[model samples]
Target: MNASLLLLIVALLSGLAFWAGRSRSLVVAGVGGVRTLNSLPFYYGSLTAFWCALPSLVVIFLWSIFDGVFIEKLVHPLIAPAVLEAAHGNMDLVMNQVRNLAASHVSAASVDPSVVAAAERLNSLENINRWAQAGVALSFAVIGAIWIWLRINPQLKARAKVEDIFRWLLFSCALLAILTTIGILLSVLFESLRFFQRVPVTEFLFGLEWSPQTAIRADQQGSSGSFGAVPLFAGTLLIAGIALLVAVPTGLMVAIYLTEYASPRMRSLIKPVLEVLAGIPTVVYGFFAALTVAPLIRDLGLSLGLDQWLAISSESALAAGLVMGVMIIPFVSSLSDDVINAVPQSLRDGALGLGSTHSEVVKLVVIPAALPGIVGSILLAAARAIGETMIVVMAAGLAANLTANPFDSVTTVTVQIVTLLVGDQEFESAKTLAAFALGLVLFMVTLGLNYFALYIVRKYREQYE
Candidate 1:
């Protein structure tokens, strides 16, 4: 049987187990009163279903993982030595040709007779494997259902057992997340260490120049590349600063208006409209930045005759930062509004009783009460701006210029990482390893921001609480 059909059969069997278990419990209760049962009928049903399905699912998962390896091993001996030698010991390529021949994806005239025989063997093994998997899985599932069903009684603590299983499932999910994070960190750290062995960490951190083009062959011109990363760091900060300048005040003011002054009807209409900005893809925002915002900024600069003192490129950090700010406005506004609303109304009332005006109450009481959450929201928006790649790539030219001016073209660390790893590049090269090093730095910077945000939150939260 196919995997999907097997899954359907398992589902049907589990459902049958649930029905049988529940009906049995109800019948037993009808004879001996409901109070005799240790758990609810629903729990008993769920416990039986779990027992029936869990073992079979494990079998299916384990079989699916190993089936391809077993089939490949079973067919490898059928390929003639000459055909295997021509494949250069690449078992994956040999298997690919075998599959293509078996499926008639490759013409018979294009491949060797030995390959054709190997393909036939592979097909036969696959068929046998599928049948064996289905048979074993179904038999185990049926046996599990019968054994568990026989154990079900009026005194069975089905609810306790089921809840314990769910608790472990939740713990496993949390453990998976932690392990995934650790894996990412370790991978980046090892790659960055490799990069640093070739390029000095001090130069990467403090050097002003930002060239990373190390040629693969010595004959290539410009092969002796600089590894300084200060320009990229400066560009990232310049754009992110502009983004925070645009986003923080605007988003906070909008949140204030919605929470403090706007009517219920106006809030209902305007909030959703504002939040719609967040749903637009970052690529779309990038297009708007490149096509519209960048050109507009350049034209505005020329019209104002500021081109003499301030040179604005068609692609500038200002445009990308502005578009990114617009994209994150809803994130800030929505979070801030929720936080502001969570402030106790009694604080406002108490401030008002002291002869304070609406503005005074908001400034002294409401804002203080909501300060920690507002700080968190702003930090979240700032992180979004820093991590953005599409807008920077589209609106800002990839010329890692070390300048404070927003009108100057610049690139971010993420854009440079992508540029370094864009093609079929060898991972062993310093160029590719540089991407991981850049990622490590970005990760550390963001982690520091989160820690600082937490510190600020805890410091102020104690006062308000």
Candidate 2:
């Protein structure tokens, strides 16, 4: 059976088990009634459904994980040793060919006779494994349901057992999330370490040039590419600074207007419309930046004769930063709105009672009280702007120039990372591995921002409480 169909069947079985357990509990209650039971009928039903699903899901999960390795072992003997020798003893290549042949991705006539034979064997074994897995899972589900149904009684601690099971499941999910983050960090760290082995850490960090192009052949031009990242860092900061300039004051003003001045009806109408900006895809924003904003800026610059004093590129950081600011406006506004609203009404009233104007009350009482959260939101938005890729790619030209001029074309760390990892790349090469090094640095920067935000939030929260 296919996975989807098997999952549906298990769900139906669990539903049936729930019904059976509830009916059985009612029968057991008898003349004494449900009051005599240790737990409610719902708990019994839940316990039954939990047992019926958990074991079956575990079996499916484990089987899906190891079945490929098991099938590979079974198929290994079927491939001729001569074929392995011919492939320079590269097991992965042979396996790839085998998988392609088995999946009919490659024509059988194009494959060797021995590989063709192994493909057929692999196909057969996979079919058998799927059926076996389905059968075993169903058996476990049925057995678990039956065992729990038989043990159902007035004195059974069904609620406690179900709660304990759920507590552990929640803990497992939290642990899994933590482990996944650790796995990402470790993977990036290891790959970056390999990159640092080829290129010096000091050069990567401090060198002004940002070229990462290495020649594939020794005779090719640019054989020893520069890995200096300073230009990229400068470009990233310049663009991000421009974006913050556009976003911060505008978003905060909007939040204040909505929170302190607008009527309930106006707030209701404007808040949703403002938040819709957040839902628009970044690529759509990118298209707008490239085609509309960039040209408009270029034309305006030409008309105003600013080109005499400064250069205006068709694709400049200004266009990208402006559009990115618009994109993240809702992020800042929404969070600031929430924080501003969280300020104590009593505090505002106290300020007003002291003969302060509405604006004064807002500025002195509300904003100060919510300063920590507002700062946190701005930092979060800054992180969002820094890590943005699609908008930067389309609007900002991919030239890592270290300049503060927003009218000049520039690129960011994310843009460079995407450029470096665009196609089939050899992992052993410094050119490809540079993407991971950029990622590690980006990760650390964002991590620090988030940690600092949390620290500010805790410190301010204690004072307020």
Candidate 3:
């Protein structure tokens, strides 16, 4: 249903764009709305299409946001008071179960009569929502068709109208992307706000100790755990630094070999093989890290006279970092290759004409020209490293150690977030809410890096262009 709604929206938006383009043309032709509509027939057509689709979509979106809660509220009261009380405040679970029961090929055994009735009511509500959504979609389709028919006139300056509509539609689409990003940031900001309320924001932000081993039950020991994030942040930087150190030179070299020196046959063979690195799953890399790379690092470090006290476990940051670097090499290399290849052949010939070696031309001209894209690639790779969960969670240690040692065990922010919210916990609690704070921090860091990277790329782009 979600997929269908999105597709429907895209289709509707396309229709609106077409109509807007046509209508704008007519309006530009100096037709007045009061004087038989200033726009061409096509312009009128697009206007009709835009109004029919956009208004309905807005309504559908608004309705969807409130529909589930509204239905749940209606169904909750109908549920037996005894059942509701027995379930306590976990009405959401009960509701979900009821939904599952209704959808299930076979229902789970329910002891409460009210629960069963509620499940039935929930099914009824789902059907109603489905019908309502279907009706709205169909109505919009009909309205769009009618608008198209009415406005599609040969006399109508559709081209002008279409262009105008197109511009507005593009503007709207751009705004939508920005708004979506803002919405995400707002949601994270609000959750982080809630987290700050339960825990002092300063204590959470700047504390040196982190002990998130909170208890679920009141009687259980360690119910109140520390929220210091220093260790996780250190771990993240340490691992990311190691990964970049490994990946950058290696990936850049591969990109150079492919773009500058490799023979046609070799390029054909090697480029795909390198790109194939990206298709390999991070979990596969994790397995390689945990089972293969980690042990290798430990054995190598041990052989290099690192004593047992200088303990480098199989799950050291170096191990995870090395493997993660391997995983991200393609991201750096592929982007670098494309950008390098895009450099003007004339620049290469010009350098060669001056008796510069192939390597020199590449070093002096091609690389400088492609530096923006290369930086963008590195930034993207850094983003991947920062956001990576599976490899870090699997290969890296869960200990929130703040040590700078590459050989020592360390946990990343993603790993901590996963561990923090892994099981049943009240979303309202400090521990659970801490995940949001960590997430916000992670997001801000990544966003800042990306923004900086893009700024550099844009500056260089203007220089070269």
Per model, state how many residue pairs clash.
Answer: 0, 0, 22
lDDT of 2: 0.92
Instruction: Indicate the worst ten consecutive residues by lDDT in candidate 3.
Output: 31-40
Q: Residue-wise lDDT of candidate 1 within 1-465, one digit each (tens)?
A: 999999999999999999988877887777676678999888888888888898899899999999898788888888888887898987778889999999889897888888989988888888899999999999888888888788888988999999998998899889989999999999999999999999999999998988777777668665656778999999999888888888999999999999999999999999999999999999999999999999999999889887888777889999999998889998889999999999888788888998999999888888888988899899999889989999999999899888877888999999999999987666788888989999999999999999999898888783544
Which of 1 and 2 is the better model by lDDT? 2
| Best-performing candidate as measured by lDDT | 2
**Hey, what RMSD does candidate 1 come out at?**
2.7
Q: Comparing candidate 1 with candidate 3, which one achieves the higher TM-score?
A: 1
Go through the candidates in order and give each one's C-alpha lDDT: 0.90, 0.92, 0.80
**TM-score for candidate 1, residues paired by index:** 0.90
The segments of candidate 3 whose C-alpha lies over 4 angstroms from its true place after superposition are 1-63, 80-84, 87-111, 160-169, 458-465
Q: Which tens-of-lDDT digit does each residue in 1-465 have in candidate 2?
A: 899999999999999999988888888988999998999999999899989999999999999999999899988888888889989998888989999998999999987898999999998999999999999999999999999999999999899999999999999999999999999999999999999999999999998998888877668676578999998898898888888998999999999999999999999999999999999999999999999999999999999999998989999999999999998898899999999999888888888999999999988788889888798789988999999999888998999888887888999999999999986556678999999999998999889888988887777652454
The C-alpha stretches of model 1 lying farther than 4 A from their native spots are 69-122, 216-224, 462-465
- Candidate 3 at residue 285, lDDT? 94
How are the candidates ranked when ordered by lDDT, highest leading?
2, 1, 3
Any residue pairs clashing in model 2, and if so which? none
